[model samples]
Target: MTEEEKKTADTGQQEEAKKPETSAEGTKEQKEEKASADTKPETEKKADGKEEAAAADASAKDDKKASFFKKNDKKEKELQDKIDALNDQLRRQMAEFDNYRKRTDREKEQMFSNGEANVIEKILPVVDNFERGFDTVQDEDKDDAFVKGMQKIYSQLQKELTDLGVKPIDCVGKPFDPSFHNAVQQVEDDTKESGTVAVELQKGYMYHDKVIRHSMVAVVS
Candidate 1:
């Protein structure tokens, strides 16, 4: 063929070879870009998962701490309530014991007073007999040894009775009281007022504030 035609054909063949190489390079670059894009998405997903795990762990720890505090607070409240109840019970017991002690002391005092009154009441007749015996003694026997001894013993008995809180109730020339004197006889007297005690027939005795024996008296009206 001609020289110019041969040169043109050679140039056309070189251009065609260059076009295939260019197309292959473009495909390889596209594949590498797509791979890079995929790796970026995976890395982002891993980072998100790690963050989520860290958040969950922190939440669990906070919940555990809150529950522990709540339990401790409840226990403390229960202990305080128990202590208060025990204190109340102790106070009640102490008050009950004090009341029992006071009651016992009062009962003992009442028993002692009653016993003394009963003994004094029984001995009243003996005391009356002693006074009558003293009245029966003659003037000549007043200086006798036996009479003097009897008089001293009677005086000593009276002094002992006075020391024991025993005293005679006054009935003569006093206003008649049913609580202190019993009227066995009534008399009309112009000198004394009505409902007045003129004479005492039997002696009445008092032990402290209580009457052991009532006075038998004659009332003048």
Candidate 2:
């Protein structure tokens, strides 16, 4: 070969070696940049995961607080309802007791009145017998022992009746009142006033200030 052709061939060989080295360096730089970009994306994903976990924990704590408060409020309402029921029951019991007391008092009063009436009714027959014995005795025998005995019995009966809150109505020589006296006969007399009682045929008795029997009387006009 010629000398110039040989020199050109040697230079071309050196350039070929330099070109391979530059190509290898450029490939290594590109690989390093791509690896750096991939690592940055992984770091950002880790930060987002941590934030999501924190938010979930906070939500769980809030739910627990709400549940506790709801349970407490329900218990408080149940307790209040029980208290109100107890108060209503107490009031009803008190009212029942008061009504029972009033009824008992009324029954006691009625029993007392009935007892007094029974005693008075039993003694009325004895009073009637004494009156019949006194009426049978003649007025001319007023000083006789039998007549005096009847008077004594009548006086004793009068005293007994007075002690028992009983009294005789005075109808003779008084104005005739239908409330206290029953007129059996009417007579015209100049010596007496009109509508006045001339004589009492039967004595009237009062028990506890109330009239038990009206006096039988003769009225003069």
Candidate 3:
């Protein structure tokens, strides 16, 4: 109603509106800090979960690599075993072939020796007849052309027999061995020892190292 009283009331209203409220501002700041604190724990838990998943994946990869290496080692061992078995089989086959070759060679040698001995045995009688015929020739006829031709032929026959590994056995004036000499008669001889060959009735022949024919002889008693 009075002018001064009205003026004072209007100034009080203006000051009250301009002044800040400390209690309301402090309460709003506290609520914002609590929201930030609550969000930090969730972010950290997500990071931890991602790290655990990465470690598990790495372990699985390592196990797979180890399995691959183990399989390769098993395959190598199997291949080596097969190679060793093949080598052993080849060695056994080579040894068997060598043994067979040696056996065949021995058989061939034995057959050849038997056949040569048989042929030489049949030819011995003809050689004895040739010697007997030569002994009957007279010394007066020795210079004749026919006798000379026969002597040359006999010499050629002896040379051929010598070339073929045939040789006459010594009987007269040598010891009488039953293997090489046949004693047809026993006689006394002062010039020779007892059981010695005094006379050779028929000559013996040897083919190589074998006696093809035995000498017919008279032994000193």
Candidate 4:
């Protein structure tokens, strides 16, 4: 009803409208802050996931590299083993070949020696006939030029045989040996010991230290 009372009522009404606007502004700021906080947790979770994925990828790559190296090492070892085995086999084959060569050489030498001995044995009979024919010649024939020439030839042949590692074995007046002498007759002799060779009917010959012929002898018993 009064002017003062009417002015107070208008001021009170203006204050009531300002209070509601302030409260609305504070509620909007609170909502904006809550939204910001929620977005921060999502962004941090995404970053952590990326880091975990990168670390897993790096570990997988490292594992693959290790596996590759291991496989290469195994293959190298196998190849080395094969090389060693081949080397051992080659050595064994070479040794076998060497032994075979040595054996062949020995056999060839033995065969040559045997052949030489056999030829010498066959020629010895001709020498014996020459000596026998000379013994049958008359004493007058010894002065003949033809007889002397025959004696020279026989002496030359004997010298050639001596130079060829051939020698005559002496059996008479020595003890009889079955290995060197073949007894053709037995005689009773008081001068020589028993089982002694009294006479040599055929001369024995040796070639290169091996007997080519045994002596035919008469034994004294």
Better of 1 and 4 by TM-score: 1
- Local accuracy of candidate 4 as per-residue lDDT tens digits, 57-91: 99999999999999999999999999999999999
- Candidate RMSDs in Å, in order, are 5.7, 8.8, 5.4, 5.4
Which has the greatest TM-score? 1
Residue 129 Cα positional deviation in candidate 3, in Å, after optimal superposition = 1.5
> Candidate 1: where is the Cα deviation over 4 Å?
1-63
- Give the 10-residue window scoring lowest on summed lDDT in candidate 3: 15-24
C-alpha-based local distance difference test score of model 2: 0.86
The alpha-carbon deviation from the true structure for residue 165 of candidate 3, after best TM-score superposition, in angstroms, is: 2.3
TM for every model, in the order presented, reads: 0.70, 0.48, 0.69, 0.67
lDDT of 1 by residue, 1-221 (tens): 89999999999999999998999999999999999998999999999999999999999999999999999999999999999999999999999999999999999999998998898788888889988998899998889999889888888988988999999998899999999999999999999998999988999989999988899999997
65: Cα error in model 2, Å = 9.2
Per-candidate clash tally: 0, 0, 0, 0
Model 3 TM-score (2 dp): 0.69
Candidate 2 local lDDT, 25-71, one digit each (tens): 99899899999999999999999999899999999999999999999
Candidate 1 local lDDT, residue 26: 97
Give the higher-TM-score candidate: 1 or 3: 1
